[model samples]
Target: MQSTYQTAALNDDYYYSDILYSPYQTLPPVIQDTLLDRQRIIVIANNPSITQAKLEALLQPTDMLVLFNDFIHAEFFAYHPSAKDLPKLLFFRQNGDSLLHFGLPPRSNNLTAILEMTKHATLGMLFGNTDYQFPLPSDDPRPNDDPITANRVLEIPKPLDKLLRSQEHCGVLSEQHSVVADYPVFADIHSSAPTSGFLLYRLLLAACLEVQQQKNADTPISIVMLGFNNENKTANFWEGHNWAFERQELATPPHGVEIIRQY
Candidate 1:
């Protein structure tokens, strides 16, 4: 019953080239260009099997957090960045979209749906360009609390909550009626697997919530992460982080997206 699908079904669209630098962690000029103008991104990992630690090594801390979910393109994007590469730390999304997506290498039309979600997506990319196995610290320090196994919503930081609360486009019940009108999505991260795609969606919303809550009142530029999980079913404050299998009851809208803000 837990079948994976393409980023398209989730209404995600964007062109991404993993390993732009080839063995280097630096992003491609196009990515840099897009990021310079906008910071918030809704990356679609599509595959969680890939190691995000290796990929983190390449990104600057200013890059922000990565929300982990789904299983679409596992091999292409994860495992590129390493802890050292993070020039800045960005947050990830925590909401769930109530939509059913099918398989990988989705049809062109599905790709179009992924594109629709990208309207406000600034930059999205996978963790690593190659399938490198690397050890990474879990988001939760407690071993008993494996994020993937525990299907529950976490309390987003105050900063992130503030941002999401401030925005009107955080959650979208329909694919066509999303935050697209709010802004133009810059990039979409891609990898070789499907789970990574789910993670990317989570990261996007989480980052947005963080930025909105923490940025200085005078800060001119900010980034927003947006994502929707279809399987999330929790009454604990609309935070998007949840487990697919644990969810049995249907959500109110039957769909939800969490937006995280990062400064």
Candidate 2:
């Protein structure tokens, strides 16, 4: 039997709205095109459940790889070494906590991780924001930098900020957690902001659909995920990530999204 969190992603009720949400329609053309053009997109998240064996069975040479903020973390790469040569895109958080991966000196573990993370990837986009400038740790080793990220920086998709900071909403659903469930969530600090992975999924799905409509032909594209365990994140007043709600959404995700649970 499939665990609720591991159930297949199949729901016709996918909702998209708000000027800041997916279908926001302002993503860089390159990011949009790469995603829509792929036959399959493999999104490897930070969840520890992901393993090399599981990925070997699902990953294909033609499949695009998508990883989040910690893509430059040595621990992350050590944990999933197959992901070291990412040839597609990377989305990262610019918040203080995430800066350590990029802020340290070149001699430390930062440079190697940066090179391995970007050498093969076409683009590296920032997902969150901070008061400080975007850190490009690889700039020290300037000659080795990839142009897409070396020269340009992407702002947080407005929808992302809106969705996260919106007091009126709860992740994919607008209802507050208190209203959505018989539980308590501190609205100010503990509101349910959808995880970056979830937001990325919505963005890619909408982009693919848009591309198909423009081509006037169906292009089969899908987002397959590995190691996305919301079970570890809980939504009590103290736990912030809206673990309960996100798990519920993933349990019944809309079409074109697949959750590869362990067999």
Candidate 3:
């Protein structure tokens, strides 16, 4: 399926409509009314498209929202200063989708393994350092004149490998009745960065799962990051690591949520 982001690009103008009731509307009563429902909704926006003020207005009572820093959803999530507190209402980028799809360094990582295993896969890597906040406008390809683009910098925590390699054991979950089973399960994705925006995305998914659980535990929710699509491999082209993407351990769902491998 085409990601919501890819669908947006196909349109003549870059505008995409929100499916939920928007706070941007002039109707305060309407906005107030929807907020009362207190539903778990996932809001995804391209970076720079939203202003701080606008974000503040939307976040007050939202269950969760995911924001992308650029055209592709990689940079902001991979290397943003605000990664730590990891607001349920925010996600951003410091670079591009490539950073997330192709992880940095030695070719022995999970991403490398995937490329080698999946014949003729397409690859991309995205980067994020929990310890480093991406520079707003100081030195980057991002446009310089946007007033909304304040020249700010932040510091995040380190990457996952540092944290995981230091640990002795990691937990594993296997279940067929859970939500993760409904979709074609790829391996679970995780990040080592403490402020890692992807964690927030995971939490947001948790919240959505909670909502789904309240009604029916059997229903499955399908969520794919906006910018990553690896498919239609050619049998003739099989260079290992050429199409690799980085991903860490799978996360265990909180209490009532079960993460099943749907393969």
Candidate 4:
């Protein structure tokens, strides 16, 4: 049977600096095994900071994909920053009789379509927002630039909500007001100043841990970090001597939620 996902080029208008992947040698043996054995791939754009070039580069190698875009979906909630100028990641996948379209908000029926797409995959990745807050414009007139408190509980789109709910194992890391009850609530970084790169790292780490527990020993889970810079701490963390397959304590915001792992 044909796979449900495929890779395509990024839109011409999008700009980016570079594309980086975790060297296969750097990853844990099991994770490396999973990537090579199951061919499961996860792609994430934690924030708008990522460039289109990098996003496309990650997709070139995988058939199973996940994209996260807080900007396009901002309309559902009241407080996300405007991403009008940003170039969106676009790609297509064959789903049964129709093509599964991505890079934009899906129509209500599209949610069911997305859920169907997930059924055939062994590993999954989440993209877009991870509960981190961005700074508001200096001249912006909102009474409170900090939207986390003002827009704490966002009712996610029905399709996306359903998709998240249906997942057997999931991980969430957001501010106090940002709630995702379906999955294991990992770190709660309530601060308004954290960078998207750091948030992506935490989310993927948590997601991988959750996946490890649920999947068999041979299953592999690979995370794609989009719009990444070499200087970001996550890049350093992966390359650092301290990195290990064993779960390590994650540095979280004040009053951060904690997760216990089987690893």
Model 4 TM-score, 2 decimals: 0.31
Give one digit per residue, the lDDT tens place, for model 3 in 1-263.
Answer: 42242233233343214412111121122222332344433344333333443433433332323432332233332333332122222222223322221122211123222223122211122223222223333433333322232222122234433322221111111122121222232343322122223333333343344334444534423333332223323232323222322122224222322222211
Candidate 2 has its poorest 10 consecutive residues by lDDT at 170-179
Order of the predicted models by lDDT, top scorer first: 2, 4, 3, 1
RMSD of each: 19.2, 10.8, 18.6, 17.9
Leading candidate by lDDT? 2
Superposed on all Cα atoms, model 3 deviates from the true structure by an RMSD in Å of: 18.6
Instruction: Evaluate residue 5 in candidate 3 and report its C-alpha lDDT on the 0 to 100 scale.
Output: 26
- Residue 154: error of model 3 in Å? 14
lDDT of 2 by residue, 1-263 (tens): 32232221122232334544444243443455565556777877765556556665676655777666534334444335454444455554333233322222221223345444444444434334332233445444442432234323333344433432332221222222111232234477633354566656555655555555555554446778766754544222335445665577678655677887533
Candidate achieving higher TM-score, 1 or 3: 3
Write the number of the candidate with greater TM-score, choosing between 2 and 4. Answer: 2
lDDT (0 to 1) per candidate: 0.28, 0.47, 0.28, 0.30
Evaluate residue 126 in candidate 2 and report its C-alpha lDDT on the 0 to 100 scale. Answer: 32
True-vs-predicted CA distance for residue 64, candidate 4, Å = 5.0
Candidate 4, residues 54-141: lDDT per residue as tens digits?
4334343343333443322233112112222121221221111211212222211223233333333332322232311221233223
RMSD of 4: 17.9
